[model samples]
Target: MPSAWLSTHLRASRPRVLAALNRAFGDIDVAEDAFQEASLKALKTWQQDDIPKDPAAWLIVAGRNAGIDAFRKKRRETLTAPEDLEPVHDGVHPEEELTLSLDRSVYRDDVLRLLFTCCHPVLRRDQQIALALKIVAGLSVDEIARAFLVQPKTMEQRITRAKKRLQAARLRYEDPDGAERSARFSVVANAIYLVFNEGYSASQGSELIRETLCEEAIRLARLLVRLFPGEPELRGLLALCLIQHSRRRARLSATGQAITLEQQDRLQWDRTLIAEGIILLEAALRKATPGPLQIEAAIAATHTRAARYDETDWAELDRLYRALEIIRPSPVVSLNRAVVIAKLKGPEEALGQLEQLAAPLERYASYHATTAALLTELKQFSKARKAYEAAIQHAGTEVERQHICSKLDALRSRVPGL
Candidate 1:
């Protein structure tokens, strides 16, 4: 198999196979080691022979056997190894038998179990997201660090601490009961969204978006929705991801510059994804649960419903943001609401609202950028230039900096000496 194809397959299979190994062995370290060993073996084996019919099952079996071997080595036990053990049925290969025993529902449950384990209440929110991205999403430590806008060493320590905390907590490896699952669901969903947001607008990189992380997040969201079909929040979460992701194609220019939503070409948007997201949003709204995800999805749906930029229902968006603020009040939500308010009201009123947020969103790049935009609209060129400078100073990525700089350059053109 080609290296690219093989890499993609391995990444896609990683969560399921690792979850299975973790469940079987009851050790995160052992499961990770086993998966690594299996991947190494695959690199050599698949190149020589044809790829396995079910690569995930093959890895699970191989990894399980590898884990047993490692355990035997650690204990120096004379126990019969996995390969030495007799098959459950006559003439049945061990891998074949194990693969047959495992089914789709088992894999889905394993993935969910792993997600919940990573998002255990014992760990902090940042740790939950970082660990899930590492263990379940197969993101490397550096990748996680980049997403968090922290040093790799710092991220490494955080992840190590999280695992140590999990070990100390003695979390159960079995599937969570209904109460436990429900309790942990919110954190799990938040972690997944954090992952998606990191990809949707990467924290720091040459590229504006990270397709792999986005795809992995969508896949995890789909898994969650399937596992809890009646959870309106999960449906809303999936809808939000799909709707936002539909614009990925138009989010960046051919030269890789960041493109604001209003400036993006709607013709490039994926209508299929938009339709699916709308359907999910409508279904979830019918449930009338009214959660944060549903409100955010409603916001995105409202944006997509507009055939043109000027046609967007700014009033409805303002209402949704207010509803979101009541449910999940945060500086970020307030900042976004101010932007919608700028559209429905005026720049002065929006600027007043933004000023109230300055204290809380001092270090946020988008806050500065939005302020600069409002200032520019009001012909406050000097203030806009200063705000744009602040935005550039706090910008996460090269592309983001470039985009803000472009605005600054345009402002300078308007006020030559200023």
Candidate 2:
């Protein structure tokens, strides 16, 4: 009688319950412990019966009650009976129980407030990301470590240190205001972007895409927008995620090979998501102060609007990349611009632009892949072969490596003596 999607439901509801516990207990350590206790109860109860109608509310109320019992035991200098710690389930209505347990307003901003805390400036960026994934996204220690290409113990330590630092800082659970809120907003936004990118391309996994993680990132971005409705960048971030994720169906071929954008079947893309992304981007643009996310969303919009690859407005894309470089100069951004140049001008021009990037992008697999493509187009067979070999060495996933190897084989067949 257990629901097949019990894990998914638990993950989705964790943030709400954990956030509420943190607010009620006013301590991250106690909150995490109480939520775990409540989750065990749900695991036992939901298997025989159906999952609660309001899972988040159920977990929140149960966790709050459990945390209160722990406090009572601690203050009394004795352990409370295990039965006394269990959530009340003596035929009480779930909603009625939740309503009597805690005020609804306690959780209205719970997730957002938790996000701000995890991304506080005091923690290192890596620590912030790990904490957010564990606390907010409900990813396991091993899952988070796999995403970071680190050992599970390392990630565990990082999270422990981050929590300890937060506890030591004695930061309260309250909504930030004015400039502090703006700073925290940017930090939280960047962390969410990192989450989406890892899911989008999977930097260190056999699977080219992790749809669940991508969906989680999008969900978090939407939550961020609701919390900070006036922030244009949050809107842009959500729009960018939706537009990019619309092509998930076309990102890999039927045989699990990586597919290039030009070769992907356009019909496979999600039109509804594309339309919503475009609307959001247009609204963000009307604000007149374009952040990096807004500019990136505009560039993605340009691609989604084109009916066919040939119809793509490369000239305009070139302009946007130029603007992006001026705003945020990154080797990765420059590499993207090289693609536009290849389309607008020619391989020779694109190759020239790419050469200067070699040093900065020495270890980047895409740098080698792009170079190989441009070299192949110019009939520089020997150099192209080397670049393809390099790309294979640097490739993150098996699919990417296989794709590059296939290209190398095709080149060998075309030029008999190579």
Model 1 residue 326 lDDT score? 100
lDDT for position 315 in model 1? 94
**Candidates' RMSD to native:** 3.9, 4.4
lDDT (Cα, tens digit) per residue for candidate 2, span 100-164: 66554456467667887888778988888788888887778988887777889999999999999
TM-score of each: 0.83, 0.82
Roughly what TM-score does model 2 have, to 2 decimal places? 0.82
Model 1 spans > 4 angstroms off: 2-10, 37-58, 77-107, 121-130, 139-161, 173-179
lDDT per prediction?
0.85, 0.82
Clashing pairs for model 1 are none
